[model samples]
Each structure stands twice: as structure tokens, then as C-alpha cells.
Target chain A: MKTTLIFLVIFCTSIANAQTLEVGLRVQKTQEMYWENGVSAQFSFAKFKPEQFFLGLDYVTSRLGTAYQSNAIKQDSYLLSGSWLFNKNKPYHIVTRFNMGYFYSDLEEDMFAAIPNTSFLVSPEVGLKYNFKKMPISLNLGVGFYIITAKEGYSPGTLQPLYYHLDLYYSILKTRKK
Target chain B: MKKISFLFIYILVTISFSCSGPTITDDLLDGEVVFDPSLYNPEQFLVSAKYPIPTPADLNKHIILAVHGYTATTFEWQEFQDWSVTPSYRISQVLLGGHGRDYNAFKNSTWEDWRSSITSEYEKLIALGYTRISLVGSSTGGTLLLELVNSGYFNNHLHPKNIFLVDPIVVPSNKLQTLVGIIGPMIVYVETDQTAAENNYWYRFRPYETINELNNVMSIVRKGLENGMTLPSGTYLKVFHSLHDPVASTTSSVLIYKGLKTSSGSKIEVQLIYSDIHVFTRLNLRTKVTLLQKNNQLDVFNQIANKLN
Candidate 1:
């Protein structure tokens, strides 16, 4: 309840200041050779500034699937991140993001003598958003380095894995009347 | 750049080494035990035994006590029965309490009922004059066996000779039980398709309240450990797990292996089977074949039989 309230407060504050909201779905595949594929939906609130900069808050919920032996590995994650657009006007926008999140996997039940648990992932990402000149659509390509930490189990230590994502979105609601 | 290049090289080498490591052959045996559905037909796909025997014999020579996961039944062990000959040991397919019977019976039973049932089976085997026992348990059963040993139930001069654990539920924390207790039983459908049946026989687990019972089972296991009893001396413990099994992760095996005490007199071996399935039902065939060829299982039985002789 406390966490939800804090989140709601931040969301309300962000919406009041930003006045612009964007929501879209994203497909991501981990660049780590041993990892699997993932998909997520992201909701962002941002405000464009006079200095050609943009600041936003993003919440993403994602699912990842992997194959192990004869079984399928699935995980669900929720991430909250802050994004800063280095340049907003160019056809390609460069954005930097920092994220903190929790991930739950069904496999945790098997840990012997340990508590069933969840993992925390902290990541910093850099990406490019290429806007289609004529259409209100854009292609986003990004890479993030995540410090994966497991809680309450025999984790294989903190692994820094490379994650890559691509998203294509068509604006359903424009921030401006034009 | 130099450090980065070295790290890349190190990773490549590690991958290569793992791939080239001794191919853990499932080839522990040759030939197959074809399943004749007619020979051992299940009376009802799901029904309780009308005539419950107070003491079931070691009906087969190569006996394996097969225990299922939560809300599971004896039928889950049927897949394994087909892969072997009428061997030297009788396989005891135990239907845990609150399962394999009327579903309503579960609501009235506690986790203690399940524990008592397993202990009774163990005592029955001992009374039958079978000196050697091997346990093949999965998920919840795995935890139960570990607890059984820690509790000193098997600590006497004679006890189970070996244990085979598949995805034992050993966790570092207890919070998941609460969450699972809240939501685990909402699922009611059981997969009846052939493939689904083959893969997941115990599809319908007990409700969330039962999850609390499972938590009780865990507590008993933990208490046994604290009491200073260890897995029986010279007993062999082998664990097999898949990397991607969503129901039971590979980490479970790792944790159990870590907690298990290995005195010089005891032999414990842990093998993490790399597979993509929740349960390695397919490996059942390989296990039977391996036992048949090496006759390792026979040798164990023969040692017992010789004493009888």
C-alpha cells in the first residue's frame, strides 16, 4: 500500500508538470548470448523544454521467455525509469535512461533451504529514437546494461548483461491539437 | 580496450569449455521398455483404491518409491512404470494424503497427514524385510524426504540406501508461500490431452489453504535440520534438474546439495540435467535402461537378497 501510494503521488506530480503522456508497446531481446527474448509495454510522461531538452518518467511491464532443458522459463518484471532526451529536434533523438525494477520467475520455488524470492535489476540505458518525418510514428532502438541481483536464493552473483530493445509506435493521441 | 578484449576472450573460452565438457550421456543403459497400455491399465484415470491394504508388499524386485509434487497422485508415476522390466524391486507408487481420492478429502487434511502417510510407507517397507530402499521424489516430496532424514526417522542402523531428487522445493525465504497461498489454488482446470497428460499428470494442485500446509511441511524439514540429524550415513543422494523448468528451478537442486551433509561415510552426487521440460519424464526411460545394463540396481538388491539367501 505504501509503495502504491508513493508511486501514485509521483505519477500525479509528473502528470501535472509534464502535461504530455505517451504509451506504447515494446519488444526486446537480450543481447547476452545465454539469455532469452522479452516483450513489454511502456507508459511515459514527458514535458518538452525551451532548450530543446525533454525529461520523462517511464513505467514498463515486461515478460521474458527462455528455454531450459525440456522446460520453458518465464519471468515477469516491472521497471520504473527516468529518461532524459539529449536532443529532441533532430530526426534521431538520443536518450539516456536509468531504471530500477523487480523481476519474478516461476523457477524460484526450487531453491533448497532458501526462501522463495524475487530479483532486482538496475540498469542504465542509451538509445536513439528515429522519427518518421511525415508520420507521427517513430522507431526506437536502445541498449541497456543491467546489474541483475537475486534476493533470498543461491543467485549466480550479480551479472551485468546487455539488453537491447526495439519499439515502433504510432501516436494515437497527439499532445498538440495540430 | 585491452581489458575488454581479454574479457571477451575469457567468455568465449568459458562457453567453449562448457560445451565440450564430458557429454553427460543419458546412455546409462541400452534398449527400451515398451509401454503396453493393456498390461498395467489404470482402472480409472483418477479413482481411489476401493480395497486399501493395510500393508502393501514390495511387489517388484527393483522397488522405487515414487512421490509426486503438491496435489499430485500415484498416477504421476505411471509414466515411469512402462520404461522397465518387472525388475528386482517393487515400485511403491504412494498417493499422498488429500490426493488421488475425492477432491473434497483434501480440504479436511493437514500437511501432517501427508507426512504421516509417507512415514507409514517407510515403516511398512522396513517390516517387509527389504533392507535397501531408493527414493525417487519430486518437488514437495523431495523436501519431505530431506526432512525425514533430518528428523531421525531414517537415522537408525538401517535406513533408505539412496535418494534421487528431482527439483526439490528448498527456498531461502518463506514469503512466496504467502503469495502462492493467496493465488495458487484459483486454478482449477486439469489438462486431459495425451501430450498434456504425458507431460503434466498432476495438473490440478491443492488450493491456497493447502499451500499453507506445504509451508508447514517445510518448517518440519527445517526443524529436523536444526536438530543435528543428517541424511543417513553412506546414503547416496543424486539430484537431476533442468535449467528452464518454470515449476522447479535448477537452483533448488543447488541449495539442497549445499545443505546436505557429506560425511566421509556417505556418498552424495548431484547432477543438473540440462533440459527444457518441467519434469524429465523422458529420462525415465534412460534411467531404467541404465539400471538394467549396469545392473547397479540389481547389485544393490542382490546384496540384500544374498543376506536373505
Candidate 2:
């Protein structure tokens, strides 16, 4: 996991120029999904169609909610995604995204080590993004399905297949001019 | 940026408020009794109260003790009790300890207390000389039945002729259910999204301590499944599950099939219904019902009835 993060950081930073970096807070709900709150960071390549398309990373968890605070269940989802913005100049753009990721759950019991703790995740989503004309923030709402491949009883029962999420983003450190 | 920050704050506030609210209730143990007299009154449900000695007619007939799931009461099995009109068999509704009473009573109950009810009922029937006995449990009740078998409780007592499980929840389908150990203390009780009508029977709020106890039993049973368990000699077991049970996953049935074995060293029987509800046998309180749903319940009922014959 450390190696993957280091690799992602190095790769995204190397192409800093001509890239649009945005950091945001994400709130999501799947079909019967518990309230999951998290941080999202995405860097869109400047040279690779500017803001029209981008590679992104997001981390969402249930740590901040009553679900986690009350010791009901805690979950974390780490996703790497590719997104496309049609008609980038429009204040409102159609966004299509595909995310590949990992899901981890802590059962808090030593006896459950043999039970499934992690799963490979893939999600395909479509939604609308509205960028304020004057402010540096963007708001996005989309729905996605996690194609969890784990077998029955091995995966978390709450992590069902379908979900919907809302993203609130802000422009962060700009890419250096080439 | 200020406007955006303000917007961000507004969005955060809105989303945070959108979280599902907690289920708070007056504890049942505050002043109320632990058991529901109306439900447990021998004049009403406990057939044993009416017939202390088996009528020659009741003698030797198959008697099934029906057990309900966690946070549930005898209502879970009431439909079956009502449906069984045949003279060949009868239903004994066993109320788990701390159930069918009040929130305080349920909140203070333990899993062992829950299992004790089943044991006591079984013992009573055994004492009455009911040699042909079977057990039918739904969800947690099913888990308790399996625990009894895994712990060899059946070996010391009279072996049940058959054990029927309906969506026994070894593996919960709700993803958050698994994390109770870590998230339980901070969120003391998990609230159910139940209607007022449903709340009349099931506990709308679940206490953390009771949840912990449930996890303990589930862990014990899950490990037993992993290690494998054998039915008591001469006992038969069959599991029935919904194809899409939202509460208890159908995979639980699969685990039971893989882990539990007959005394003859053969695989136990399992049937997967093509329905999509948990405890498909209970049709009341459901908002919608299809022909398939009714058929699913009848199929299991018929199967159990057939075994009795």
C-alpha cells in the first residue's frame, strides 16, 4: 500500500505543469449505504486535453459519522479513477467516471482474522458537475456501483453493489507554468 | 474562495444532518417485567399448559419448537403456528429471554439468556414424553440452534429429529454489521428503520452490549463452521434461505452446508428460495407480496410437514 501511494504521488507530481489540481470533501450514499465521509484529490493533465479528462484519487471512510463513532462499523474505500468532462468550458458539465479501488473493514475482533477483510472494487458512474462561475469550488453528484468480487460471507454485508455520492471540490496548489 | 468555503460549510452541514438519526427509547427494565404475560400465558400459546399429559391423540406426534431471531419475538413464528392446522403436528412458540417485553428487558438480556429459552422449552417437551421432536429457527434463532449442535448440547439431551433453519445469519448481509466491534461503543445502539406497526413487535433500538454478545456467538459459530461440526447421531438438518435476503445473506446457508455434516458423514440438505426478502415465511408487515413470495413460504412449510409425516 505504501509503495502504491508513493508511486501515485511521484507520477502525479512529475506532470505538474499543464495539470489542474483540485482537492475536495466527498459525501456518498449507495443503495442502503451508510453515510461515508472522506477527502478527494484529483489532478487533471494539462497537456492531456487540459481539464477535459483527468486521473484522480479519492479516500472515503465512515470514521466521522455516527456509524463509526458509535462502534457500529467502520469502512474505508480507496479509489483511483479516470474521469472525462464533456464541454469543459460550460459551467455545468457532464461527467463520466470509472474507479478501480480497494475496500477495507475492521471487525475489531481477533477471532475474525479468517473472515474476509478486504475486497477489490471497481465502479462506473455518471453525474453532473457545477463549477461556480466566480468561485474556485466545484460541486459534483454522481451514482456508481461497486463491482465487488469477494465471495459471500467474505465481504461486508453493507457494502452492496449500488451507491450514489456527492463531491465538493476546491482548486488547490496550481501546476507550475511550463 | 470565501464564497466557496462558505458553500463547502453549508454542504457539510447539510450532509451531516442527513445521516440517519439514532433510535432512542425508554429502557424496558426500568419498571416493567421481563416477560410478556399475554404472549406466554399457558392459556393462550403454551399448549403444554392445556395438555400436561399427552392425549393419546397428541402422543408420539411430531412437536416443533419455533424460535424467532434477535430483537424479535414469537411473532416471527406466529404465521407458521397459525398455518399449521394439521393434527399430525403442533407448534410450540418459545420466547427468547428478554424479548416480547420492553426495551429495557431486551437491552439487559444476553445471548445465553436467549438460548436458555430454547433449552427450557425443549426440556419441557422431552419431559412430557414427546419423543418425536423437531426445531425450526429463523435468523438468530437458527444461529442458536446451530450453536447448540456445535457445542454438543444435543448429544446430552434428546436429539431433535430435524432442525430447520430459515436464513440463519452466520454471515450478515449488512456491511456495517461486521464493524460493530469497533463502532459499537461510540454508537451504543443501532436503530432499526421500522414502522410503528413493526416496532410493536421488534425492538426498534439495539443496545451495544447485546450486539457485542451477538458478535461473540456469531464468531463462535463461524469458527465452528470453519472447523466443521457434525450433527448428533440420528439427527437430520435442513437449511432454507432466500436468494436475496437483505438481513441474513444466503451465503450463510452455504456456510452451514459446507461446515455441518450428518452423523452418516453426508452433506446436510439446503434449499435456496428464489425470493428476495429476509424471513420470507413471515408475510405480515410486508408492504408488498408477490405470488413467488407466498410460494416460497409454503414450499418450506410443505417440506417440514412432509418430514413430520
Candidate 3:
């Protein structure tokens, strides 16, 4: 179990090569649940997969989307992910990624303090990314299933397992003049 | 070719098992029970049925329609009826349509069909000149009540005086519950592990079709909540949820608080019970009852009874 955890940590997170920083927006929807929209940021290091590998952080919440002057629960998710591109130098690439994060849904009242409103988030995702060659912009479409860490009723009800996201990223720097 | 044949045979056998139904001797509600007792004699279970003609005094008494969850019959709220020994209010246990019966009848029923039982009973009381009427629903029963409010069902009818929800399910705790369509064909139906006494009250076998209906109503209510819903003028709603309900998530109550508003645009009251049982108000026929559980049940019961009086 420890080895699996370590392997997952290594496979899904920070390892470096070529340097390019991308910051953007994420539009997310949980299956049959809430619409959570937020921001995303990614960066990669110097040699070994170059721009093909990226480590990212994302923060999404219903407050900005479905809960905006609406009745949806106010919840937030913070995720750290490692994504690997299937193609080396292409305008379009398939992306396989893994993420680990935390989730919380504010019950707003003190009476429900004991109810499980927090959970550790773990998910594996697969998607497609499209890069605009002339402009340093990219559009990504991804779907992910959260690996539920607790018993069914022990997790926050609004934190459903299946979700899809579409992200738009703008490259702030070149592939580090490789 | 031999391996392919073996795989095909295996798949066929699995499918056969999936579609298999219980035998007559299974001693399960799916095969053993003809129908819920309330269906056979609603007059004995529903106040509206028993007192079709109000005595003017009967019309003044508050009528609380008690609705049970998915697969549950009028038996779920039997304890409340037995406990309420006062004339200030009455209990009408309306069995949802298509429940407490054989598997086929259950498989053929829709959520709308299930909710009709509640509507028909409510309409009957209204037609009988019972002006003081309230509603109490548990689990999916609670969901249906909220749906009624969300869909504006009370617009044409008399407004309910008070609505009490116990462990309503807006979002299911079982994450795979969302994927029933994909897995339903292979699974056909689900059999719960319950005692014999429970079998006489709740459906032992849950058909995929009914599960789909459950999902459909939940989806409708959730979307409506997203858009926001309000109670009728002079109506009051309060949701009581178990802190760690195994069947329905506690977040359901949170949604109820956020989405449903009282007549004056104020947030509805929501209380998280200290127990873990899905419907803490129903302790009858349970295998083991804890003191705390009993206290929780009595607490809600007394609270409801007090409000009625």
C-alpha cells in the first residue's frame, strides 16, 4: 500500500524538464450534480519529456457557477495534477493525467458540523488538448472519475465521482529555449 | 473457437441469473406478499379514506399525510400513528403507488405514479373539507414532497400548512447509483439483505426500472433547486436529517436548506439528527434499537406532535 501510494505520488506530480508556464480557466461539471468553474495553472521543467509533461493546480467551486445566486451547495475543490502528452510535437495531443486534492462543501450552519463535508480527492483523467500554433493558447477537454477514499455515506454528497472539464490555457513563456 | 464458445456460454448463464426472479417459497416480499396492507384497505391507513365526510370538527383538525420512501409501504410510519394518541392532528400513511406489491407491478411503475398516491390522498382530504392539512415524508418520500413544491403542484390545490422532511435524498450516497442505466441490464434487479419482518414491509427486490424512476425524480428536483424554489404563502418546511445516514446523504438536507425557501423568502429550518439511521423517526421492526436512537425518534415525534397541537 505504501509503495502504491508512493508510485501514485510520483506518477501524478512534480517531475521536471523544459520550462513553460501556462495559466487559464476551467469550466467543470460534475455528473448529475453541480457546475463548478474556476482557474487552472500548469508548468513543466527542463529535459526529459520537455513540454510533454506538466504539473498543474486547479481550484473550482460551485459558488462561481451553479451556486451563483442559485440554490446549489457552496463547495470547493483544490487539485494538483500531473499530465503527460501522448504526442511530442503536435497541435493536438491526447492527455492522460492523475490528480490529488481536497474537497469541502460548506454546510453554512453549525448544526451540521459533524456531518462529513470534507474528503481527499484522487482521480485519473484522460482527454484531448488542442494548441493554437501561432498563438500561445490551448484548449483542453477532459473527463475524470474520483477514486472515493471513504465509504459511500462518509463522503460529501455533493462531491460526486464523475466530472468533465474544459480548460483554456495561455502560455506565458516559450518552451524555455530548449 | 473453443475459448470463444466457453466465453459466450458464461455470458449467457450470467444474463440468465440476472433476469431470474424469486420463487414463491423465497419468503421475500417480491414473491411472498400480494400487496401492501394500505392498498388492500386504504380506509384503515389513510385519514381521508376513513373519514370521507368531515364532522366539521374533523375538518378543523390538522391532517398530516405520512409518506414513506422508495420500496417502503405505509408500514414505515406506523409508529407515528400508534404514538399520536391526540385528536389535535391525525396520521394518514399513504403508500406510494406501485410499492408494497409484487415485483412486476413495481417494475411497471413510474415516479409520477408513485407520487400520485400522495396527491390523490391530499386531494381527497381537501375535497372532504379538511382545511388544516400538513405533510411528513421520509427519504425518497421527502424528495417527492420537495418535487411537488418545486414543480408548483400546490398552485392549483390548497396550500399545505407545514411540510416536514426526514432524510430526503436529492443526491444518492452510492456513487454508482448514477450509472444504473449502464449496469441495470446486467444486474436486472437488486436484492437487499433485510430481516423477514422488514420483508413484510419493504420490497426485498428493487427493480432497475424503479431505480431509474427514483433517479429521474431526483434529477428533476435537483435542477429545480438549482433554479430555486419557494414554498406556498403561509407554508412552513423543516428538514431533519441523520448526521451519517447510510442510504441518503446528509448533504440532501443542506440542499433543502439552500434551495427551498419559506413563504417570506427566508431559509427553511434544517436539523441534523444525532443518529445514523436513514429515517430516525421510524424505529419499528428494526433488529436492534439503541437508547440514543429511541430518544432521537421520540424527539422528532414529540416535536412534530407539539407543532400539530
Candidate 4:
């Protein structure tokens, strides 16, 4: 376990060398859903397209406040996202994002292991972003819905589909000088 | 560019308000009566009412309190009363606090008021010295039952013999239902696309206030389920759900099973039937009833009857 942890950290730091990378924290407030808090890391591989396109990844958990602290239904989600920004030079940009992810929730009971409570999730989002000129920082606000594809009784009941989030990002690596 | 941006904002606001549907008249009693007025004339509907006295024979039989869903009246369980041929049990159909009247009554009533009706009847049965008592709730009724268990109401009061839930709305099957809290202000009331017969029993128009109340209580019970609840000692529970309930999600049963345990820490009982309708146990006055629907109702009825016997 110790060796695996060291290797995982080295791998994550190496990936930060991508042309443009932004690592951030995300706070999400769901509509009639639970409060989920998580960390976000995003990078743009488009040396040609520059800031217009980006690849993002996020891991969110409700365990911080509601699930692990209060309720037994602890949920962890890891999402991979692709995004498009309509304007390149403007400080403020209109953004659309598509995300795909895997979700797992544990009821903390041995008897419920038979229920299919985990699911694959797909979501589409729309948001606005502001990039600060002086400071290498950005903030984004987005709303999205999970297009739950699971049949009835196969998905977790607490995992509703609609949510809005705020992302505060610090620029780790700037877009390659063009 | 400014013109385009302004137009976009205007359209978004317009759509938000448009989705709320329509508003009900402010007058709380502005609707036609659906059930026989004579039934509540002397308050015979309420088991606590002095008009109807339970004889020694009535007290000997098991008492089952039947609760309906949101915006519904006692008529939701009227079919059960009509079809129950055996004298082994008696059905006390309860009209939720704000229900069975006009639209205004529901608009102003809170969830607590709606729950009071069930508690009142249960206390009445106990006061009359009845030992065998059970509860059957459809939709929101089931949510309230779960709330009762989570609050430890039974541990303090008389422990019920059994609790049966049919298509409870812990998690709604309709995705749009969750948005009611956000869209409620613009759409003061939601209109139901129901036939005249259905309207007579269920409120044709649902007030946003009541919808919020339902959401509030459902959220409480849902959190309880997530944390897991222990059934009151000596009480039994069984949840019956349709495979594809269009109103209440089938996941509701799954949550109950996962989150709730019997007094002895055993998993609660659950049964899933094959049907696509909401409240599958209420079979009266529905359009285009199918063989499967009838069978679904009988299946649950037999289960409850056997338990009573």
C-alpha cells in the first residue's frame, strides 16, 4: 500500500506538465439533493486549439458532511469531462461541458451488498467562467443533470440527477506561449 | 450582441415561469365535492367521532388504518372497503388534514397537519382497547409511516402489529417532481391531467405549498432511511411496490430494504409486482385497467388478508 501510494503521487505530478493545467476545488449544491464537495483537476492537450478546448477530471464525495458524518449512504464519484469555451481572449467565457463517470455508494451493511446500487453516469452541463488576468486563477459556475441509464431499483435512491456547482481553480501551468 | 444576450435572458426567465403550469384560485374551498357528503355528515369517517361506537365484536376484529397519498382523500382507499369481504379486519379510511375539501385547504396545510389525522385515529383505536392494529399507506402515506418509525413514535406509544407500504414516494419516479421546490413560486399550483372521475377523488389542482410540504417530509424520511432505521420492537413491516411505478420510484422499496431493519436487526421484507401504474393497490375508477393490474391488486390484498387472519 505504501509503494502504491508513492507511485500514484509521482504519476499525478507528472501529468501536471500538460500544456495548460488548472487544479481546483469544487463545491456543489444540488437541487433537492445532498451537498457534495470535491477536488477538480483539468488540463488542455490542445496545443493547436489552445484555450478553446479542455479535458477535465473531478472526484466528488458526499462523505464530508452528510453521508459519512451523518448518514450511512456514502457516495464517491470520479468524472472525466470534455469542455468547449466559446471565447478565447475574453476574461469571461461561455462554456458547455460533457461528462462521463462511475458512481459507487456503500450502505455500510453486509446484507445490502446484493443490491445494484452503483451505476455509470453521463451528464451535460452549461456554465460561465472568469479567468483573472493578474492572478493565475479562475472561477466557474455550472449546472448539470445525470442522464441515469440504470433500470428501476438498480440505482441508488439518494442519487438524484440535477446539481449546480462552483469551481475555484488555480492555474498550475499556463497555455504554451503562442 | 447586447440585443442577443438580452433576448437569451428573457427567454430563460419566460421558460422558467412557463414550466410551473397554472395557479389555483386562492379560495381554499373552490371545488366540487367528490365523495358522498353524508359519509362525513356526522363524522362517521373518523373512528374517534362519538357517532360511531365500536361494539365488542368490532373491537375484537383487527383494525387497519388506511392512508392515502398527497392531495388525495379517503376515497383512495374506498375500493379496499368495498372489496374487503372478510370480517377479519376493518378498514378505517383516513382523509388527510387538508384533503377532501377545497384547493385552499390543501394550500395552507402543513405536513404535520396531514399526519395528525393518522395519529388521531391510531390513538382512538388504542383508547378503545384494541390490541391488534396495523397500518397501510399508499404513496406519501408510506413516507409518513417511515417517519413514525424513525421518530421512535411506536417505542413510546403502542407498537403496531404491522406496517404495509404500497408504492411509497421516498424517491419520485418522475424527474420533474424534484424541480417543484424551485419552480413552485412561478407556478403557484400544478394542474393534473386527470379524468373527471379521478378529479373527484384527487385534487385536480395541486398547490405548490403542499408540494413543498411533501418534499420536506420526504427529505426527512429519506435521510432517516439513508442513516438506517430500526423498526419498533414487536412491529412488522412489508413494502409492496410495482415494478414500474410512474409516480413513486421502485427505488423507494430498495431504499427501505437497505435502510431499515427489524427490531432484531434483520432486513425488512419487500415484494415487487409487475405493473406500471402508481398506487397499484387502489383499483377503483382507473381507465383501461388490465389483467396484470387486477392481478397486482389481488396479490397484495391476499397478502394483507392472510396476515390479518
Q: What are the chain B TM-scores of all models?
A: 0.62, 0.88, 0.93, 0.88
Candidate 3 backbone collisions, by pair: A17-A45, A17-A46, A17-A47, A18-A45, A18-A46
Q: Write the per-residue lDDT of candidate 4 for residues B1-309, one digit (tens) a residue.
A: 999999788778757865654444433223644443424562545554632577887778887888989877787777777778997887777777887777667778999998998998898889887888999999999999898898888877888999999989887766656888876766767787777677667788887878899989988898898788999888889999877777787767777887899999998898877777789988788888898899888888888888887
Quality class of the docking in candidate 3, CAPRI style: medium
TM-score of every model versus the real structure? 0.47, 0.62, 0.89, 0.82
Q: iRMSD per model?
A: 13.5, 10.4, 1.2, 3.8
What C-alpha lDDT does candidate 1 achieve relative to the native structure? 0.51
Per-residue error for A177 in candidate 4, Å, reads 0.2
Off by over 4 Å in 2: A1-178, B1-40
Ranking by DockQ: 3, 4, 2, 1
Q: A-chain TM-score per prediction? A: 0.66, 0.88, 0.88, 0.87
Number of the top lDDT candidate: 3
Worst 10 residues of 3 chain B by lDDT: B24-33
After superposition, candidate 3 runs with Cα above 4 Å error? A1-18, A176-178, B1-26
Q: Write the per-residue lDDT of candidate 1 for residues A44-142, one digit (tens) a residue.
A: 443445213433333332223333331222344456676667666688888787777665544433432232335676889899888788987777788
Query: How does residue A65 of candidate 3 score in lDDT?
Result: 85
Better of 3 and 4 by lDDT: 3
Cα lDDT tens digits, model 3, B1-309, are 999999898789768867686553445566644567887797899998798877988888999999999999888899999999997998999989888877888889999999999999999899898888999999999999999998899999999988999999998988877767656767778788888888877888888888989989999998888788899999988889988888899988877777788788898898888877788888988889999999999888988888788
**lDDT (Cα, 0-100) at B235 in candidate 1:** 71
CA lDDT of each prediction against the hidden true structure:
0.51, 0.77, 0.86, 0.79
With candidate 3 superimposed using the best TM-score fit, by how many Å does residue B121's alpha carbon deviate from the native? 0.6
Report the lDDT tens digits of candidate 1 across residue range B227-286. Answer: 333576667677665444545545555445544665453525665544434445433323
Among all windows of ten consecutive residues in candidate 2 chain B, which has the lowest summed lDDT?
A: B26-35
Residue range B1-309, candidate 2, lDDT tens digits? 999999788767655643533544443322243344435485456556656887767866888888999888888888887888888888888888877776667778899999998998788888888888999999999999999999999878999999999989876776666556655655667777776667767777787767878777876786687568999988889998876677886656756776789998898988777766889899989888899899888899889989987
Supply candidate 3's per-residue lDDT for B116.
97
